[model samples]
Structure formats: C-alpha cells, structure tokens
Target: MIAIDNILVSDDVVREQFVCDLAKCKGGCCEDGDAGAPLEKGELDEINAIYDIVKPYLTPAGIKEIETRGRYQYDREFGWVTPTIEGKMCAYGYRDEKGVIKCGIEQAYYDGKTSWKKPISCHLYPIKISMTKEGEVVNYEPRETMCRPGCIQGKKLKVPVYVFLKEALIRKYGEDFYGVLEQVAGSYFAKAEKQNK
Candidate 1:
C-alpha cells in the first residue's frame, strides 16, 4: 500500500488493468448491483438540487422510482445509496437506443443542466473506499465476473487501473496527489520490470 496524506492506496490499483467497455458491458455496473449507486453524504443534497434538471432526461420508470424512493436510502452493507428500481437499475438510470444504461445525472451534466457531475462514488467505480482506523483505504475491487470485457480491453490498451481511473482519482484526491501516485506507480512498475528481467 502507498500512503499519501490521509489516504491509503492499494498496490493492486497499479498492478491490475481495467477500462470500462460500455459496448460490451452496456453499463451493467449500474444495473447488476444489489443496491443503487453509492453516495457520499453531500451527494444527497446535490441529488435533491439536481433532480429537477435530471428528471427530464430520465425514463418514466426512473422518475417514478425516484419519486417513490426519495432519492437515497441506507443499505445494510453499502450504508448510503441511491434508490434502485425494484432493486435493479438505479432510479436515475435510463437506457439508450443500444440498450446501454445511462446515468440521468450524467446526462444532465452533459446537457449543461447541473454543475455537479453525478456522485463521486459512481465516477470512481471499480475502486471502493473503506474507512480504516488509520485513514481512508482505496482498493481496486476485482469484480471479474461483471467486468471481463473491461479487463480484456484494458490489457489490449495497456491501461492500468490507476491510469483508467485517473480522472476519478484526481476528482477524489487533488491533481497533486494523483501526480504523486503516478510517480509512485512509475517507480513500482520500473522496479517490477528490473526484478522480472
């Protein structure tokens, strides 16, 4: 693990490869989970504030689910989560013509309806944050069954998990922290290359 400020980053994030293949997965992560998208405490407020703007883009089913579920809920395992439709697709999800699940919140953001781009948790997917006695521990979740296509694509593109998640990492931790992480990853990979040779 590498420590930067208060965050502990797992080495797997550097060693592993991943890239979301929306065509193959069709945004399955948003629909296949037991619960809805995870949310930070502050995100609740944004959901409420942006619901009006996002509502227009959402499907009728999504709108109904949101109206009934009250935007967010507490899960036994995930704690705070966005409500799901009958424990399936997120209340904020819509399907495109190709049947790819799309985030209504993100659609609104792209449409210039809201400044806050969906939940940070959603943006930083496949990487989950857990609170330890020491600090926040960031780990790459290996949901291989769900993300096989991404794994294949990542290997083909030579994109490590850290590189694939660069934008989200920078969003969660500042650019300086991400830069430091990049340096650490470079050193780690370089050392591995030397040992392998």
Candidate 2:
C-alpha cells in the first residue's frame, strides 16, 4: 500500500493493467451490478437539481424510474445508489444505437448542459474506495469474466490501471496526491526493474 495524504492506494493500481473495452463490455458495469451506481452525499442533491436538464437525454423508462423512486435509493449493502430501471440498468443510463448502455448525465455534460459529468463512483470504476479509521483505501479488484477483454486490451496498449484512471484520481485526491503517487510509482517500478535484472 502506498499512502498519499490521507489515502492508502493498492500497488496493483500500478502493477496491473486495465482499460475499458466498451465494445466488449457494453458498459456492463452500469447494468450488471446488483446495485445501482454508487453516489456521493452531495451527488444526490446534484442529480435532483439537474434532473430537468438531464431528463431529456434519458429513456422513458429511465424517466419513470426516476420519477417514481426519486433520484437515488438506499441499499443496505451499498449505501446510497442511483435507482435502476427495472432493477437492471441504472436510471441514469441509456442505450446507444449499438445497444451499449451509457450515462445520460454524462451525455448532458458533453452537450454542455451541466458541469457535473457523472457520479464519482461511476467515473472511478475498477477502483473501489473504502473509508477506514486510518484513511481512505483505494483498491483494484479484477472483475470476474466481465473485465477480461478490458484487461487484454490494456495489456496490448500497455496502460497501467493508475495511468488509465488519472482523471478520476486527480478528481478524488487532487493534483498533489496524484503527483506523490506518480513519484511512488516511479520508484516502485524502478526497484522492480533492478530486482528483475
């Protein structure tokens, strides 16, 4: 584990490789999970506030789910999460012509309707975060079956999990923390190189 500021990050973030192969996965993480997209405390209010602007991008089913259940729901195991449509894809999700699910809120953001792109948890996927008495722990757990193609693609492209998640890391921890993480990754890989030689 490497501690930067109040965060303890797993080394696998640098050791392992991953990049979302959307063609293969079809954004399955948004649809396949038992729970909806995890939400931060403030994200709930943000979603509610921006509902009018984002609603246009959503499907009729998504709109009905949001209207009936509200923006987010509480799951005993997962805390607060975005409500799902028929307990499948997230209420904020929509499918493209290719039948791949995508985030409507992000689509709105891309269209310049709102500044908030999407939930942080959705953005920080492949990296799960947990709060401890000591600090926040950022971990990488390879997904079973679903993420295999992404792993293969990442290996082919030579992208480390940390490198792929640069934007989310910076969003979550700030530039200073990410800079320190880069330093740690540099030293860690250099040491590994020496040990191998």
Candidate 3:
C-alpha cells in the first residue's frame, strides 16, 4: 500500500490500467448497482440545494422518485445514498438520447445551472473508499464484467488508473496529495521495471 497522509492506497491503483469506455459500457455503473451512488454527508445538502435546478435535466421518472422519496435516502448497509429508481438506475440519472445512462446532476453542472457536480463517489468510480480505524482506505475495484472494455482500452492506451483519475483524485485529496501520489507511482513503476529487466 502507498501511504499518502492518512489514506492508504492499494498498489493496484498505480499498477492497474483503466479508462472508461462509455460507448461500450453505456454508463452501466450508474444503472447496475444495487443501491444508488454513495453520498457523503455534506453532499446531501448540496443535492438538496441544487435539486430544483437539476430537476429539468432528469427524466420524469427520476424526478418523481426524488420528489416522492426526498433527495437522499438512508441505507442500512451503505448509510446515506442517492435514491434508486425502483431498485434499478440511480434516481439522479437518466438515459440520454443514445440510451446511455448519465448523471442529471452532472448535466446540470455542465449547463452551468448548478456549480456542484455529481457526488464524489460517482466521480471517483472504480476507486472505492472506506473509513477504517486508522484512516481512509482507497482501493481499486473495477467491475470485472462491466469494466472489460475499459480494461482493454486502458491497457492499449497505457494509461494507469491513477493517471486516468487525476482530476477526481485532485478533487478528493487536493493537488498536493496527488502530486505525492504521482511521485510515488513513478518511483514504484521504475523499480518494478528495473526488477523485470
């Protein structure tokens, strides 16, 4: 594990290559999960504050779900999460013209209707974060079947997971943390290469 401040990052985060192939996956991550996207406590307020502005970007069904159940719901296993549409897709997501599921909140952000993007968990996907007794533990956990195209694409393009998720990482842990992670990754990969040689 690579220690960055209090967060313990799995080595696979630096070693594994991954770049989302949206065309192939069709944003399955948004629709396939059992529960809706995990939400941080502070994000609940953000979602509530922006719901009105973001409503237009969502599907009618999604809007209904949100209105009926409130902005966010509590889950026994996952604590706070965005509500799902009848246990299917996230209520905050809608199918685009291409039939690909997309985050309505993100669309609203892109349209400048709202300043906040989607949840941080959704932004930093394939990297699951869990709070441990010590600190936050970050792990690389790509969906085996759903992420096949991404895996192939990443390997072909030679983009490591850390590099692919640079923006999200910076957003989550600040630029300084990411800078240290990049340095650590460089040194780790170089040492591995030398050993292989």
lDDT of 1 by residue, 54-90 (tens): 8889888878887876889999999899988888998
lDDT of 2 at 60: 98
Flag regions of model 3 displaced more than 4 Å. none
**Candidate with maximal lDDT:** 3
Q: What are the lDDT scores of the predictions, listed in order?
A: 0.89, 0.90, 0.92
lDDT of 3 at 166: 95
Q: Candidate 1: misplaced stretches above 4 Å?
A: none
Ranking of predictions according to TM-score: 3, 2, 1
Enumerate residue pairs that collide in model 3. Answer: none
Best by TM-score: 3
Error of 3 at 197 (Å): 2.2
Instruction: Count backbone overlaps in model 2.
Output: 0
Error of 3 at 121 (Å): 0.3
The TM-scores, one per candidate, come to 0.96, 0.97, 0.98
In terms of lDDT, which candidate is stronger, 1 or 2?
2
Worst 10 residues of 2 by lDDT: 141-150
